[model samples]
Target: MKLSKPLIIGIAGGSGSGKTSVTNSIYEVFKEHSVVVIEQDFYYKDQSHLDFEERLLTNYDHPLAFDNKLLISHLRKLLVRQSVEKPIYDYTLHTRSEKSVLIEPKDVIILEGILVLEDEALRNLMDIKLFVDTDADLRIIRRILRDINERGRSIESVVEQYLSVVRPMHNQFIEPTKRYADIIIPEGGHNEVAIDLMVTKIKTILENGTELYYDDDINQ
Candidate 1:
């Protein structure tokens, strides 16, 4: 049987807003099928030409920091039933790896990133858009812990970057894009009610064999 068009979901939020958790929950439910997950961070433009110090100074939270055009092309390919080799970015090294992840065309596509909803072309491609709203205090704390424990960063560096770049970028670019979200999720993946609703909606789209961009603000 021919499968219906893939459902493209965009999950956007500030760093450490639990976007990953929300995405993981959805992925777990649909793991039996062909589901490809992509991260905007993986499409960060190569900074191999720049010194490590220069790369560190790059405004990662800014939309220009990502190779969005490439990402959009990849997503378009997946939508048309074509496989793509997604890039792999190394956070610790501040560079993209030579290797790429081979992702087959999927029945569902989940694009997760802090600035995923900021791009116009990318936004147009999404079947559903979600924004994870979390308090700045909570987000900063989570970012600190994640960077220190997972990304091997020092507490001072993390705090400095948060104050200098992350906070400002989120205020200017990320927060403004919240209006574009079809659903605004508070507390991220911890909100089971919201997650369940979203999952059910996706399942409904699959079962109905059609995509509903909006149904009189049904989910809002």
Candidate 2:
């Protein structure tokens, strides 16, 4: 069944804070339904014009690093059930790829990113705003492992980048957006109770065709 209006869920947190884990949990619960995930990483600004060294200078954790204007525009089209050619970013090249993926509109859209809720325009588009509150130590550990194993980065570089960019950016931008969230999930995906509650809430909206405001006391 098609929804009268798409449900947009914004999941935000610090780098390696289990935002992807939380997103996967929600997507798994509604996979049979018309659901799609839009990653903020895909919207990183193109650095093709810059030299390799200049691209290396990019502070990725900062809000300015994202191509939010393009992201916002694409999201608006999806909200109206229009398909968009989503940009693809190449991590190895430190810039956007030449190709784009065509994304059809869905009943549910999960916007996952470190800075998803940082911008007012983006936050306003979300039906449910979530902040995954994971500890610094755990996040750093996760970041180190993912960068080393998946991105082929050295542990030293990962640690240095986290210390010089990620940690400070989280404090200055990401953490403050928690105040705007409808639900603050502690321990990220490890918080089963919170994830269940969130799933239930989404199901209710889908079934009843109405918006339900979550109680502040239920945030764990």
Task: Give the TM-score of each candidate.
Answer: 0.93, 0.92
For each candidate in the order shown, give its overall lDDT on alpha carbons: 0.89, 0.89
What lDDT tens digits, residue by residue, belong to model 2 across residues 1-220?
2335688899999988899999999999998988999999999999999998899899998999999999988887887779999989888778999999999998889999999999998997789999999999999999888888887789888988888888899999999999989999999889999999999999998897655332222211
RMSD of each: 4.9, 5.7
Candidate 2: residue 15 Cα off by (Å): 0.5
lDDT of 1 by residue, 104-183 (tens): 99878999999999999899889999999999999999999999999989999999999999999999999999999999
What stretches of model 2 exceed 4 Å from their correct place?
Answer: 1-3, 210-220
For candidate 1, the clash count comes to: 0
- Looking at model 1, residue 147 earns an lDDT score of 97
Best by TM-score: 1
Whole-model alpha-carbon lDDT for candidate 2: 0.89
- Angstrom error of the Cα, residue 124, model 2: value is 0.7
